[model samples]
Structures are given as structure tokens and as C-alpha cells.
Target: MLTGALSSRMSSSVSSSDRIFPPSSFGSFESPGIRASSCFSGPNADMNEYDETDLFSISWNQDYGCFAAGTSHGFHIYNCEPFKEIFRRELKNGGFKFVEMLFRCNILALVGAAANSSYPPNKVLIWDDHQSRSIAEFTFRSEVHGVKLRRDGIVIVLKHKIYVYNFMDLKLLHQIETLANPRGLCCLSHHSNTFVLACPGLHKGQVRVEHFGLNVTKLINAHDSQIACFMLTMDGLLLATASVKGTLIRIFNTMDGSRLQEVRRGVNRAEINSIALSPNVQWLAASSDKGTVHIFSLKVRVSGLDSITHPNSPQGPALFHQNSSTSIDPLVSPNTGANPNSLLSFMRGILRKYFSSEWSFAQLHLPGNTQFIVAFGSLNSVMIVGMDGSFYKCSFDPVHGGEMVQQEYVRFLR
Candidate 1:
């Protein structure tokens, strides 16, 4: 590792019993609007604010093969495919508020919880699990909002600024200024051939896209309200964003700021917990506080866009405009999970976009009043991780889009 430490230390390992219970049924429900910051828990809350059984944080690895959960004790890692606990560190002196794994490797970016005196929140600790100690550390004047990791670089997110560094020598490469981002919202492309980074821009509802391969930066005004959550495809070519309004989810082309498609989650405002795109980019899954997970079919394809224009063309990005008349078909209704259309086709233009916008093709309903994040799993199934310590794997129908069948359920934490 970076510290050149090869010696290992003995640490306590906690064993967890995995219980496989019968699949449980779910139903949908809706409530009032939730503030965009509810999921982030604001800047003041700490590990002491939660009960001993409650999780301080939960996040998936870069490829979603596994996830890390931080608790009052320490942090635990779980495998997604076999649904087993890989390993855990029960540190008696400290707890982690953020434990980000680097694609199932031994290296992790850790930010300690407020109650952890040994490791403070303002410091980023690069822990090498093989050594059972921190190899490299970065201390800042202010609390860190988040951290992103890649094979070649490390990104540190602060309230108003983001710092990028090379992984080999830990050399500072670039820094960016952003709005008041308490959540430390940032995403990076996982593909090794290209480098793309997305984060909040300097203005409200704007997203800054840095395409390192193309040597270009594009700013997209994604929404009118504040951005709630967004996700970039593994290739970093497509970006899906949701606003605080939570009514519409828009997809954008990272090469040039252009809206590719717009899908409606609901007419009412809600807090979106997470969004996921299939590996093929043909399906998208989103979860909100309304206790529902919606999946939408994507019409755009990568090959189709590449045929339109060269990536370096000076004219404009070769893609279909979101509002282009040719992009819409009035004759056929949209493929969605919502009720059948009631309005006449001629009256669509007179009504709000909600009346004519595309909706999810399939849905999986869970209980409301809890936070959840979704990811596409193998064999047309979706894996959902909730803050309530619930984990589920449900399968959806690709041909007949409707309600999903719950395949397996487990409580990862006791």
C-alpha cells in the first residue's frame, strides 16, 4: 500500500448469522413531500443521534458486487451475489460514518463518526484492511461531505470544494468549487478506458460534467429546483437526474448537454432515495420515499447515437432533442406502470407534461417512511438495500411489465 506496510495486526472479527426467510409481500403508499436533505441527515447529526441498532451509513461498492454498512460499533462488508458477510472490523475506539470500498479491494476510504475520538470527521483515512491500519490520511480544516474512489485517483468532497488527487503518488491534480453540497454528491465512471466525473455545478439545479478523455467540460441545467439525486452509467455516457420536485427524471448526454428522455415518477413531490440503470442501459430503476420502486424502458441506444455524429464535431452533439417533435409519438400510449390514459390525444399539448409523460414499466412496492437504494442484479432482478436493515432481491418481467415478484428477502443486520 501507500504506507509500504506489509505486516498484519490481529483484530476482532464479528460473525453474523444470515437468516433466509420466506418472501414477503409489499404494497404501495404515498405521503407528503419530504425535504431533499432528509436522507443526508444534515450536517449536525452524528452517530450519537441514532440508536445502537440503527445504521449510520450504507453504500454499495463501485460495481455493486458488495456493500458496506457503518454502525455504532464499526463497519461490515456484505457480498451481493451469495448474500454473505465478507468480513468486519469491530473497532472499540472508533466508529465510521462513511466506509467506501474500492471495488471489493482491501483499500477503503473511511470518515469516522462524530463519536469516534481517534478518527475525526474532518480527516479522510485511507485504510488498508490487509494491514489492519490506516496507510495514508488527509486532514482538512472542515468536515468532509463524502469521498469517491477509482483505481487511479481519489476525490474528496467538501461543502463548497472538491479535491482530486492521483492514487499513485497522492499528488493533487485538480480542485473544483461547488454550491452548498452537504451530501457530498459526486459520481465517477467505472470504465477503465475513459474518465468522467459528475458533480453539482456552481449554480442551483446545474450539473457539471468533466469528460477527461475528450478534454471537455459541459454544464447542464438539469432542473429548475435543487438536484436531489443523480446516477451516471458505468460508461459515463448517460446521466439520469432527479430534482427536489421529484416529479420528473431526466436523462442527459454527457458528451454535450442535451436531454435524451424524461420519465415521470409521480405528480406529487417526494424524496428520491436512489436510481439505477441496467448494464445495457435499456432499463432504469428508481426508489423514492413513496414506498415504490419503478422501472422504465429506455429507447435510446449507444450505437444509434454514435451513428449520428463524431464525438469531436464542432457543430453540435449528435442526438435527438428531448422536445423534438420527431421524438414523440402521439398515436401510441407510453409504456408505464401508471393507469391508462384518460385524456384525448389532441388535448395533450394543453395539459401539463405529467399527463403525457412516460411512466415506469414495472414496479415493486415496499413500506413507506424508510430510505432505500436500488441496483440491477443478475438475471433481470433488482437488489434493494434499505436503511431499516432490510435487503431484498426481486425479479421483473421484461416482456409483460407489471408488478415484480419478490424472490428473496434478508435482514442483513440484527
Candidate 2:
């Protein structure tokens, strides 16, 4: 197994029968009394067999290669492509609220659920599966809302504060205080050379950006209402944010905190569950409470030299792109491929802005009652994981930009 190195390479889809978990690989030194549930059926087929409330949390690793599912019994790590459960650790009295993996290594950062007396919700346990015990721990006065893991450092998110610590020595590196962030909303860039942290500011609808590489801090007033959900690209060059209203999502340039693009989700209010960006930065995916996944095309491209050009320059596409050696200027052309403007769109600037807001190029529909998180899979494809243990792998039409085709589905938990 390539567990030592962090791999972000994407893979093609496989057959459904090929994804079944191998019982032979279920037994491990770290897990005791681990057993698989009975076969799963339709969506509403079997509710009494298992407790739905046992599922506490689910999160993707830094590279989106694998994801950790935390339940009241224990936690399970599953590979993303074949959708197989790699391994699990089910303690006798163990349950977890958060199980964060540091890449694909044996090390994990765990925060306990309230039901498990073996692990406490207020403490962060650094567990090394190879050693079969926790190597270190950090206990806070209150429950931990979230935990983020990287090779070099560990971040702990509390209700009103975030703490950064060194992974090697567990020494305190820095501390940040923010508004009442019950959701523990924060994002960290995975790029090794650039370390950027995005978290809520001390005020409403504001985000604080920490450039650890340059020792700088920037504050961006992103939205009118409080920020509901946001995401940072793997390279940390771009950020996407949505407010409490959930009608629009704004993309910003992290380096300059400039608004690059604004796309509309809908007029009705909904809770934004998750947001994702393609590895090539060509597409952005977002999920909400309405049970629809929106795919917005960020079709910005420069034909020739890097010079300032009007949005209607007729040469470049309508978004932003960043290179390691060259910096792309921030440009906004919200109506890249959306429908033509309405009759009243040209009357006022504000009216034009609303009518010209970009719409999703493609969409996918699932159960409206379930919450989901999405990530880009292989080229032109997406992966959706729902709170109800549903895993869907779907592909989109890059050219047509309409409904996405479902390629695979599995009830991974049952």
C-alpha cells in the first residue's frame, strides 16, 4: 500500500461488484470485535437495523483520496476510487465526533463523541495505529468543534477560538479568536510552500486570512450576512464563500482578497453544506439543503500575454487563474455562459448584477433530506458522500453543461 506518501492523483471508475469490502482484510491489531452489518437495500429499506444517529461526522483527507467516517461505535477509513473500507478501529467503549487523517499515514487526530466515555469531546487525541495507542493529547475546556491535520502542524477549532500547534512537539505556535463559530468553520491550504489559513473574523460576514509564509494577516468582508460555508483550493490561491442567505456564492483571490466571481445558487434560502474546486480550477461544485449539487464553470483563460484587458476584451475568458511564476490579474465577468440578460437587466447596475449572475453549468439531484459533501473525482467526474451512508460517483458533460450522469452508487456504511 502507498500509505507513506500523499497522493492526489485521480483514478477512473470501477465496477460495483468490485467495491465490496473484503472480510479477510477487516481484522487488524488495532480493531477488536469489528463486524460488518447485514447487506444494504433501498434508501428507506431498513431503518430499524441500525441507529442513524450513530454517524457523528465524515470528512475527506487533505488530498481527497480517502475519507474518514466517524460513528458512535468507532471510525472507518475508506479509499475513494474503488470505495473500499481500508481499515477500522472499533473500541469497546469508543465513539468519535471527529476523525481527521494526516494524509494516508497511520497517524490520526481524534475528537470523541459524547456517548463514548473512553474518549472525551473536549480533548484531541493524537493516535498512531502502528503503535496501537495515543501518542499525545490536547485537552481544552470546551468541546472541540473541528480538527484539521497536516504533516507539519495540527489545528484545533473551538467555538470562539482556534489553536495552532506543532505536530512534532505539540508546542503552541499561535492562537486566534473569532466570533461565535459554532460550526468551527475554517480552511487550510495543503500546499507545502504556502501555508494560508482562513477562518471567521471577529465580526459578522468577515473572514480573516493568515499568510503564515509571509507573516501577514488580511481581513475580507465577504458577504452581507454571516458566512455559512467556504472552501479554499488545494494551492490556497482561491477561496469560495457563501453567506447565511445562500442565494449567491462569491469566489475571491486569497492573495489580494478581491472578488473574482459571483455565482447564484438560487433565490430561496438554503444551508450550504459543502463546496469544492477542481484540481485544474476549471470547475467549482457546491451542495446545499435543497438536495442539488451545482457545478459552476470558471472558464477564465488568457489567450496571449498577461496584460490588463477589459472584461469585454473579446480575447480572454471570464475568470482568474494563478501560476507559480506569474500572477493573473483579478477579473470579473459574471455572465460567462449564463442565460442572456432580462429586459429590465440593463435598467440599473444592481438589477444587471442580479440578472447577470452566473448559473451552474451542470447539476445532480439526490435525497433532499440528507446532507452531502462533494469533491472532484477523475476528469469530468464528481464524488458525492451523504450523511445517510450513500456514495455516488457521477460524471458531467463538460460541453453541454446540463444534468450529470450517475455512474456508481453504494451504501457504504450498512
Candidate 3:
């Protein structure tokens, strides 16, 4: 076990939960185009350059075309088009614990940590930054891990349960049961009444889903191994799940709860930190403890890109949604793992606690390491940010040969 002092000494300057994604893809580098910036390279905004000593958190608002950042100093918002700062609020208080924005609006949910007096650790304040104070606050007895906001309501996740509250009045609407989850793996449909929540299930290798609008609970017997990570699309139309094995990644249809396709992440067991879908739900990106980031094409079925490719190369979209009927045919069942009764399978189960290697289709090896968050900047471009405050923007041309070019980079902390 890592001692507290040693763990603190080895910890990264930033953690995955503190990073943010660009609201949309920036492939063209034209509209919300970000050219190489000398902002942090030279005279910076307010001379507030990022250093390892600061605790920072960030998020991007596509609707507002801006990004919000929280630091030990204070919280601020910046525009993407011109790559300039719009405003920064100075607060030496724990700055902000978990900060979330609503479509570039003045509405933000602020969770305070040790330093902030405006709110407590268990309280979530519906912040009206226009007024620079909280208009509504919800208090709980337990420490809040994270807070998620949707148009209809807000979801607050605890270690064992989840609560959904109405946005207009902050009234409790639904309470859900989950496993011991510290990260709050909940994703709400951006435009619909649906939301997906995963918690520990009836047994090992199982996951529990609480669907709000549909009024149903789904138990996906997805893997023989324990579930590692899962994510829902913005529209809640699909779900991507990975197991502890880290050898297979499966996509599901939320409407009927059917496995649509399965793709191999690798044959080895690795710790996966994050999985995210593109704005169009056509691309799926993931990152793990291996110090390698992977982007998988979801435009086609997982049986193989053979059907949708240009018929010359084995690269293109994995048309999961388009040819749904054919994609689910029994003959093309993707071999995710070995037979349940195989001797090798039994051996793997016993040896899983040790380390193993996993492979990704479109992988970019990072120069340094920590858990990272993966997001699509544009259809052809991806952004990878390490918990240690390392940032990278890489663009790849998958059709010809998936070669990633580091387009831009910046270190948030020295």
C-alpha cells in the first residue's frame, strides 16, 4: 500500500476528473478554429500562468462557444474562437470543487471544498454567476462526488445511491441505487428525457442501469469479468461498456437493451479510465492506465470494417447504427473472449489481479503518463489530457494509414 505521504508525493498535479473537452470537433481548425497560441508561451492573461501548485478544473460549453475553468485562485470563462479570456473571479477559497456550466449561460452548479465558505462539501449551489452568488442550494449529509446537470433536472451521485432533482424548483424526483461508485458514472441524454446510470449489479461482471424516463431497470450481463467503465451518448441512444478484462468493448442500444456491436480493445487486462463518444455519436474514444490513448471508429459494425470500408483498405466508419439489422446477425458474433469453460480462461481469471497488456486500434503513445480523458476535437482529430496536467491535440488520417500528428500542445502545470 502507498503511504499517505508517498501517495501524495507520487500523485499527478492534475486528475482526470478535473479536465474538460471541447464542445465539438475542431477538424477544419476554421470556425471555432484554434491556431497555435502563444498565450501561455508569452505574456499571458492576467499573468495567471498555470503551475503545479494550483488545483484546476475545466469544461467546454459548445452552445456558448466558451470554456469555464476553476483554479485555486478563482473561476473564469474564456472564448475559443479568438482564444482569449472573457472573465476571471478571484477567490483564494478552495476555488471550486466540482464546477459545471449550462450552454455558456450564467447558470453554474458550484460544489465547494475545504477552502470555499460560500458552500460546503455536501452542498450544491445553483450559481447565478450573473449575480456572483448562489440562488439555490441543496445540502446532503454525505460528501458529493460529482454533480451532473440536464435541461429537465440535476443528478447528484453519492457512493451508493443517486438522486435526481427538478431544475426549476430543486425538488427530489427519483432516488436510485448503485454500487460503491466514487466517480459517479452517470450520463444524461442531452436532448431527450432519458438518462443512463451504472452501479454495481446483482453479481460480479454485472452492471445495473436505472433509466429515468422509460421507468425500467436493465441488468447487462455484459462480461464474465467485472465491469470497468461505461458511457452513454449525448442523446442516450447508445452505450459503450468495457469490462475489467479490457480485451473487449461493447456498444448497446439503450431503447431495447440489446448488444449492437462489440470491438476488441486488446487481449490484455488494463485499467480504463475514461470513454467518450463524439458529438455525432460516430466515434468512440477511450484512455487507460497504459499511457496510450485509443480512438475507435463507431461508424460501422464491430464484425469488421470490411463491409463499410472503401473495399480497398480495412479502415472506415464501423456503421453500427446504419446497418443495425445486419450488424446483429448471429453469424458475425465477435469473439470477445475465450469460451467460459476453457482452461486458459480459468487461468486468466486467476491471474487478472496482475498486470497485462491491452491494444487499441487508433493509439497515440503519450510521452509522459497519468490517467487521461479522450475527446473528439473534430472527426479526424482527438485531444488527450493527462491528470498530471499534460495536454495534447493529435490529428489522424485513418483512411490512408492512421498516422497521428501532434497538432498543438500545452502543459497546464510545470
- How far off is residue 364 in model 3, in Å? 0.9
Put down candidate 2 lDDT per residue, 168-197, tens digits, no spaces. 655568889999999989998887777778
Where model 1 places Cα greater than 4 Å from the true spot, the runs are 1-51, 304-348
Give all TM-scores, in the order shown: 0.79, 0.79, 0.69
Clash number for model 1?
Answer: 0
Question: For model 2, what is the C-alpha lDDT against the true structure?
Answer: 0.74
| Stretches > 4 Å off in candidate 2 | 1-53, 299-353
Total backbone clashes of candidate 2, pairs 3 or more residues apart or in separate chains: 0
Relative to the true structure, how large is the alpha-carbon lDDT of every model?
0.73, 0.74, 0.58
Tens-digit lDDT track for model 1 on 162-272?
888777655677888888899788988877866789999999999999977677899999999988899988767788999988889988878778787778999999999
Among all windows of ten consecutive residues in candidate 2, which has the lowest summed lDDT? 5-14
Error of 1 at 52 (Å): 3.7
lDDT of 3 at 157: 74
- The CA lDDT at 248 in model 3 is 76
The residue ranges of model 3 lying beyond 4 angstroms of the native Cα positions read: 1-52, 56-69, 76-87, 115-118, 193-204, 299-359
As for TM-score, the candidate ahead, 1 or 2, is: 2
Ranking 1 against 3 by lDDT, winner:
1
